[model samples]
Target: MTATIEQPTKVRRPRATLQLLRITLVLHALLIVAQPIAAGYFLAGNVDAMTDIHATIGGSVWIVAFLQTIVAACYTIAGHGRLWPTITSAALVIAEFVQLTFGYAQNFAVHVPLGTAIVTAVVWMTVWSFRSTARLSRREAKR
Candidate 1:
């Protein structure tokens, strides 16, 4: 009689939605960072150019935040991401809208601090999303 040896199968990790989330999150973070820099330029006396640039970038951040929320939702529903990322993303979008309103109303007292908080939150999410591994489903692990 001969003894047989068994080899374990290798499984591939599927990270499509996760990758999408990371990419969008990073892009959103970049946009969030750019807003303050543009505002600084405007405050530095480049009002005409920097003001337009700041407004454009500020609007762009909202669109990116909305997309990030959607991507996070997909990631969570697909069983890859946790609930917190989705929750945070939704909250970030709402906060961003409030920040936008504050800016339009010339409420710097609220806008400045809220902008700082938004940037901090987005940066944290981007770093966490990229560094952490998603919870893999059994079906995914077997593949």
Candidate 2:
């Protein structure tokens, strides 16, 4: 005769705070993606109207950055996200401010590469947030 034992399984519940964070991350990624497209249209002379659209998109990035910071705070306070995401989000806000400054000053040397880096970073974070179950579990464990 053999005795078999089954271990208890841990069930994870989806939290609204995490859901909000995920939504914000997705929006941030979209905003980051749009900025370059708008700039490209303006630079290519495809449309003179694209200049205003580009500036509008650039300004909107600041609003998204602010939203990201708030959502990061909510996630941290709720113990649903790790410290790194919040830290990176905060850093990105600062970087965006600098990027805006350089852009307004027409300093393409810093503005172009910085914009590229921002887009890459935001996209990476958005993908990671969507795919990292381990991170989600670890963060929930801290609660």
Candidate 3:
């Protein structure tokens, strides 16, 4: 008997919904990172405009977080993917809203810590989205 070697299967590209999820994840992460930078500029008195820019970035973060939730839902249902992304995205939306409220209220005690949490969550999701575990097929998800 002769032994035969098997070739590994080629990796396939992610479906459209997953691609959208990844894109939104990256975009959301980028926007989240910009928040602290803008705030730092304002705090350092580098420019008066930094305050408005920081506020604008916060609003943008909320919008993108909302959009990410929608995309994650589509990815989960339409693409037959894991549910965690959807849940995480939704939580981010709620957190972002609270962050904005506290910021406007000048509640730095809450706003500052919440901002740190938001950044950590966004970074975690962004990193996970690109990992091999995240790209596993629906079969693995069911298992």
Q: lDDT for each of the candidates?
A: 0.81, 0.78, 0.87
> Using lDDT as the measure, what is the rank order of every candidate, best first?
3, 1, 2
Clashing pairs in 1: none
Model 3, 58-97: lDDT tens digits are 8778889999999999878777778889999999999999
- How do the predictions measure up, each by TM-score? 0.81, 0.80, 0.85
lDDT of 1 by residue, 38-128 (tens): 8988888898745588778776787788999899888777745566788899999899999888888889999999999999999998887
| Backbone clashes, candidate 3 | 0
Worst 10 residues of 2 by lDDT: 132-141
Instruction: Find the candidate with the highest lDDT and give its number.
Output: 3
- Highest TM-score, which number? 3
Which 10-residue window in model 3 sums to the lowest lDDT? 8-17
Per-residue alpha-carbon lDDT of model 2 for 1-143, expressed as tens digits?
99999987664433665677789989989888988888888777867535577676787787788888888777766644566777888999999999888888889999999999999989987887777552464436566
